[model samples]
Target: MSARSLRQVTLLTVVLLLGASLGLALSLRVWPVSCPEAEPYQLGRTGRCVWAAWAADAYVVDGDLEQARERVSALGAQAADTVCSLAVGDCATCRGGQAEAGADLAAALGLACPDGVEGAP
Candidate 1:
């Protein structure tokens, strides 16, 4: 092949490789996890963490402080303390006295809940 054609082919290959690498990195790094109908214990770390956080929030909203604490305990003692704070009138925007601390903890853990109206009864 001509020198110019060879250079063009090499450049094209480099671009294609870079594009593929970027696509792969994004797919693996920012992928979504959906495990509806499964218990938190049945999921991977991210899914489990998210479920526990949301469940804690649900329990808090329902005035079930014991269950909320149990779910938050799965996250960690630090998380439990931070989240449980909301249960004790420490929050300014808790809905109808329901603490939203679980959602905060989930977000802090770098996970977003699946699309839907959160905290719907």
Candidate 2:
């Protein structure tokens, strides 16, 4: 191939590679991003509630019911207050997390959550 043509191809390949890399990076970030909506246990926000719920679930899985209850109760108390402050995306995420945790905790405690709250996979 002519040198001019080769240079053009190389540039295009580099551009495409960089674009792909950037897209991959962004996609990865979207999936496993850290909680950024609230301070842990300090604010009465959905994020805090969700985090507490998750903590409760983990505690329950580890066979600690008292700790799990404490976590869920605290989160539940705060959830209503913080729900309004969260953005739509954050609110949905927080609510989902809380529900999942609550369900897991309930299951661990042998309580029937007949409402069928979803749990995280």
Candidate 3:
């Protein structure tokens, strides 16, 4: 093969590999690939955290401290559990994000978080 043709082929190969890697990374972010057993728990925790945060924020904005506090406490509990089961590395990052979401919920609710929670964001 000509030198230019070989260079073109190499470039194409590199592009394809990069595209594949990017796709894989994006897919992993949206879909849970490992820990099938933990998938349900993760999804439940995520949903609960999100809802709690929204509710707490609304209550806080409305000056309903009591309701906000209740929501925050519930969120903190969910965050603690979700953070605890996450492994190191990328799993840890995902779990940490969940924990942060929970913390945000608690903050909005004006509630003090409990101690000894794993991966407190």
In terms of TM-score, the best-performing candidate is 3
lDDT of 1: 0.50
Q: Considering summed lDDT, which 10 consecutive residues are worst modelled in model 3?
A: 81-90
lDDT against the true structure, each candidate: 0.50, 0.50, 0.50
Off by over 4 Å in 1: 1-26, 34-49, 77-121
User: Which residue segments of model 3 deviate by more than 4 Å?
Assistant: 37-40, 43-121
TM-score of 1: 0.31
TM-score of each: 0.31, 0.33, 0.36
lDDT of 2 by residue, 1-121 (tens): 9999999999999999999999998886555544655523222232233455446557777888887667656666543223222212234444334433444455554443333234311
Please rank every candidate by TM-score, starting with the best. Answer: 3, 2, 1
> Considering TM-score, which of the candidate structures 1 and 2 is the better prediction for this target?
2
lDDT for model 2: 0.50
- Candidate 3 on 12-114: residue-level lDDT in tens? 9999999999999988666654433333224432232234444555766688868776765666775433333321111332433645444444444434345
After TM-score superposition, what is the CA distance of residue 112 in candidate 3 from its true location, in Å? Answer: 11
